[model samples]
Target: MISWLMLAQAIALGAIGAVVAIAGIMRRPFGDWVLGAAALTFLTLVVQVVASIIAPIAGAGPTGDLLEYWTYLITAVVIPPAAVLWALIDKKGEWSTLVVGIGILACAVMVYRMHQIWFVQVA
Candidate 1:
């Protein structure tokens, strides 16, 4: 869970979400853009997970509690796949928009979780 990388991903996801939402509102198709963004996000998550595992073994700073970090990591990794699946399953524009909305919300929550991991009083 690199703080900078997490923040960057979250922001990128949020921006993509906004673009999808706007496209939806305008009665335009945004699936291609959504798919591309999701792919990028998934790739970033994969890299982040690998780096997180290697960092601690190489004597980096405290990687935080394993359970807490894994929960966030899993959720972050699952989201893009879930969103893409949902989009694929539904051809309706409304449902596609809903999926984007969910992705945006997930990213927003992840942003808060990232902040907590970085600055909160973890007991």
Candidate 2:
């Protein structure tokens, strides 16, 4: 994984998580802003998927266990959409928002972990 891309993902997801959290704290329901943000974050993960495929070909392959890295990456890619669908289906207002917030924050952490596995930990 590219270092800058990893950092960008972390920061963007963290910011989105914070925003969603604040909306939940304010007792807001699942709204367009939240949905839009989640979609945007998911789009970034799609980019990450493409980058992961290309990076190895470009000589930036992960130094850690490929399985672990791919697992984290796959999970990160799945979280946003799943959380959004859960929120929409549950329609529990602030609770739904909070759940999505938690999922986004979790994705941010996973992105950081993926960075570690890619660049910090060596197999």
Instruction: Give the candidate number with the greatest lDDT.
Output: 2
lDDT tens digits by residue: candidate 1, 10-120? 787677667666766666654677678667767877877787688667765343466676678778888878887877887565667657656765765775575566445
Residue-level lDDT tens digits of model 2 in 90-118: 88655888878888889899999999998
TM-score, each model?
0.77, 0.95
Clashes by residue pair, model 1: none
lDDT of 1 at 92: 62
- Stretches of candidate 1 exceeding 4 Å from the true structure: 61-63, 118-120
For all candidates in order, the CA lDDT equals 0.68, 0.89
Error of 1 at 105 (Å): 4.6
Top candidate, metric TM-score: 2
Model 1 is weakest, by summed lDDT over 10 consecutive residues, at 114-123
lDDT of 2 at 117: 92
Evaluated at residue 81, the lDDT of candidate 1 is 84
